[model samples]
Target: MAAAVASLYRRVLPSPPAVDFASPEGKRLFAEALAAGTMEGFFPLVSCFQTQSEPAFCGLASLAVVLNALSIDPGRRWKGPWRWFDESMLDCCEPLDKVKAEGITFGKVACLARCSGANVQSFRANLATIDDLRRHLVRCVSSQDCHLIASYHRQAFKQTGTGHFSPIGGYHAGQDMALILDVARFKYPPHWVPLRLLWDAMNMTDDSTGLLRGFMLISRKTAAPSSLYTVSCRDENWKSMAKYCVEDLPNLLKGDNLDNVQTLLSRLIESLPAEAEALIKWVVEVRRKEEGDPSLSKEEKERLFLKENVLQQVRDTRLFAIVHDLQYANNPCCNCSSSSEEDSLTRIAAAVCCQGAAMLSGNLASRHGFCCKETCLKCIQANGDGLKTVISASVVSEGNEHGVDMLLPMSSPGASSCNSNLKNNVVKYPSSADVLTVLLLALHPSTWLGIKDEKLKAELQTLVSTDNLPDDLKREIMHLRRQLYYLKTCKEKEEYEDDDLPSPKWLG
Candidate 1:
């Protein structure tokens, strides 16, 4: 019966691509296949959007990859190559936010492409047949003329989600699959997908415009992938913006009163997920009406809002709810240790100044850098919602230096505490490093590192073997161990910079 179900699933749903698209050996095979007139390899190189901040801009992110592949600047009028990020494309193009809020439309996509100065041609049902698509896609790409993108239902390929947008780097006609370059690399790897299934997905009408899904091509004459752009993460404008976001978020989390909280929330609405933003808007309106009309005093508004709005409805938002749960879980023990005094910014400063890498210490934000091995054996896993802040903080400047790395100084108030003789300085928005380190730490560094996966598993065993954690923390530890096993053991691991967080040469 199990075998029968497996067989039936295989027949009904197209399997994901099995190619090792990340290895150097894999790179060689792919290049040879492409040069020999087969679309069977990854694009020579593409900057991945792993650890991306926004959840809904998959289409825009995929489009960014397509535009980057063609060396086309989505923001044509924008100053330098460094001036525009993949997120820059999404943020600058307001239509994308609406597409995320309302729904993605072909017209919106076309406008985004045309704004990049590319001559785009859309191919779809009846507008072009399967044979027509095969000719255009296979011939142009195989012949080294151009590349194209496909819009399809992710479930057609047995993926977990609904609609998706991704670029196709190769075509394997014998098996009849188009090699899909998924921009949501963190969620799914680059894989081969069946054309018939892709077409079926495309044939489904769009709810936004009642039109079928399709492919978009930037003509051969105008499109060519550019190699000069290293990445836009080092840009001054974006980094400065990141600094502001980092400082503001923690403060917003620490907001003491209703008025201050509202003002802070208004500033962060654009950066938040749709549900959270909408909830904030509704609550703000309630306050506006009641406070302005004299039906309630400011104090009454605050009390009513906290009880009727924040305490209940705020949790309805996916991001905020997760944050709240983690907050409660972490609040009881945040500053219990000597190393727990520094905030996120100070942690970033210590790593950058003391080690020249942007990373974080454990739960304290920064640490004293001693007794690590001894502490590791007994310390409970640093579990909290603060780890989410790392991603939130990173979202701003992840593109600032090298696509989500922050260029920060090697000095802070706590730098001397870890190492000797580092001068103190005021810190602003934490660097890209702060976000990266925290994110890596959030996963409980032991499992994320290739060298430490098994060793940490053993360490976790020892910690769990000991006595006396609160029931909630022990629950967190159990959850962490399960997740750790998955992270450490997951198959088809890509050579994403070796899954090791970036560090300074001195740290090595």
Candidate 2:
């Protein structure tokens, strides 16, 4: 049985035009390219070459090699005492089991890369010229700083398979050839194909996306991936959550007292999976206090520092206070005007803008906030109770630079779709910043301020005092206090600047 199985493995797929790297002609071409100094990508790619875990995982395998070669930290533990990229961990966009069975497409591959924190430039063959592709191929193969992945029809090279993905290991400018570092090492060796031929292969349409197959230029992001939160790249579930935030959540806030709003906040927090809730709490309460031991190695210290810096940025956003302001915007006694539904919607829009922007680390307000605001106002006016389902918001931009879209399904007011059922499938967790947002809002001064109930105010004050609060919560509150003070001073300075009087140096 062993002999027969080995015999089956020995058979090579029918690839005609491609020259196997081990063959004499292929070796000659490679040596010539090396001597000509065109093999820049070869060394890095060869060092990180990987075999696909499954036949349909060529994209995943190719991506892992580039990610590792770029030295990007995976953020999550790959094994004890280490973090690395592997095929199994590339499920930020699609499930591993699904990718193992059905393979992945160019867009999804790009989505995964974006979520994983790479700076990716994707080009569809139909939209790009052959000359344009040649320029990219030459630039990638001549540099170790970036890498390229070719998504092409395997049969275009006379291979037996259909769609496939592999990294371009080198480019021979004089000969106009590209060295393909095939990920499916079980069937094929690294092969050389003419650059134009590779272009022809990529120009074919992908049935899954109904777009031409393409190539992606991937490199390490200037900033590392966030250690605190990640976007759920799943389309439908993200939409449902966004719709909930834009429509349902604000509706729940209307005319409700602090007690009811607190209950609602708890309900939303409870909606998260146990794993997600635990992760958020651990990051907030535990990780914040972890000033890594100076006794550890330099690399460990750098990782710890990166984690601390990102978390500090989250803290600096004062997201919790913003969320608190939104929740209390509709209070009967608050200064917010809601005499007309239009006014109410406008306030909701502003709150949503602040909440979404804060959750997104301000990217949403600059890029997509106006669109979301306009959509909400129009939907409320045109539809009322029949408000259309929002396809997405900035939930996916939590730690993402490109702000990938995540979709969610909308249910009726009482029938929420944002629940733990989304765990490990469509969503990861609510943004840690969002969880912190609600957590901090609970301690906001407005929650207890102007209250007639002396007993309730005293109880809340007691809960917020340093003696009653946990160390981590206390630190967070202090951070919020400092941040709010800074904002107040800045606003005052701006007001003074607007007048004829010189701005105060003390404020500065």
Candidate 3:
């Protein structure tokens, strides 16, 4: 009876002891790292810092290093529905004993990084060979585009330690070694380790997942907008589109087009000769310099800016020239020119940028023409007849000349049950940034490319396959695909063809 009662109530395990903080050797090592420019440089991490007051937190400590490196502002844009993930809510900083007891996992850590907008990718290390490990370092850490979080067993590497997490700052290829920026400063100093040893360490099985401990790469996510947004071809909207497209051009050119203009121009921005980068920056300064000068009247200032800042030299680069040429080669751009010289330069920049986006996304870019700004592909389809007329005429059309109203009701007869069932319960996206892309993909059956039944599952499978793609994105695509599939099926059953369908407001 006594043994049975004891078995019914488990004993609370004691927390692990903390690492020594004030050791003289630890301070010296930290100072050396500071001198080597290892920390994020925003703030100093003292010798005594540990992620948790009690128990092991090498993972949390390592995470702090990466987040700090990314210049993450813990207070801004990070507090939302996912605020539960904030440092304040974390067991390390918060008094959440239960959470501390539960600990963190590779999956949880990866999710947090994604939520923080880091393009994070993880690979299993159990099967990684020594050469495979070298390749990972060369492609990730050595490239400088990513900071790696290494999960490995210290004992496996012959270190008097257990499982540990840390970042690798760089690689010494000639030496066949890596610079380990260990976050557990008190336990282990930052140092160089041979590739073979590191590989063996990574191959250690993780206690939590029953999988080999490996590494994750975190960097800024691809900042380009998808191919769905396009430059408007309509006369009224073209000017505004041109002006707005300048800042967005770099990304637009780099979107998902098969031609991939970025293949040729991706590195052009950074690869520019110093003189060219200076010249690009100077172009904007030319106008600003005039704006600040006291001697020049407003009119003279404008003249100087136009003459000096808007230089043919700046525009003559191989990059801008190709972009500008592509814009002109495009048809229907004949006389939609801007009246103001300032507006002209702005529009030129916009055209160049739009062309760049077209290159990146493999989508056709419009130069001076109007593009339909409808929210959904169905809306675009509803205006297909008008779109053809306007596009073919090679001229700007105004104000729904083809009567661009929604052709399908928000709730169709066949889809009403499905739509109603999932309406309020639809999965929410972590960010609204990629809605246009998902909406476009959900348009029609042929576009589905044979993904008919279980369309939502198919869409999710496609999204989940993307490296470092967030779970929220997969959920969003699933919800949108569900709505779209139902809508398409319902529309097919309707007797009326395109024009006879419901009006544009149905998209609401």
Q: Which candidate is the best by lDDT?
A: 2
Better TM-score candidate (1, 3): 1
Q: What is the lDDT of residue 339 in candidate 3?
A: 36
Q: Which has the higher lDDT value, candidate number 1 or candidate number 3?
A: 1
Model 3, 12-117: lDDT tens per residue?
2111111112345334544554454443321322222234333455666666667656544332112211111233223211123333465555555554454444
Q: Looking at candidate 2, what is the lDDT of residue 82?
A: 49
lDDT of 1 by residue, 339-382 (tens): 44345434443332222112221111121231111101011111
In Å, residue 30's CA in model 2 sits off its true spot by: 0.6
True lDDT of residue 464, candidate 1? 23
Cα lDDT computed for each candidate against the true fold:
0.39, 0.55, 0.38
Task: Show where candidate 3 strays beyond 4 Å.
Answer: 1-54, 72-99, 223-508
Q: Evaluate residue 208 in candidate 3 and report its C-alpha lDDT on the 0 to 100 scale.
A: 62
- Scored against the true structure, residue 206 in model 2 reaches a CA lDDT of 80
- Please rank every candidate by lDDT, starting with the best: 2, 1, 3
Model 2 residue 116 CA deviation in Å: 1.5
Error of 3 at 396 (Å): 63
Best by TM-score: 2
Rank the candidate models, highest TM-score first. Answer: 2, 1, 3
TM-score of each prediction: 0.38, 0.57, 0.35
Q: Which stretches of candidate 1 lie over 4 Å from their true place?
A: 1-32, 40-53, 73-85, 90-96, 143-145, 220-508
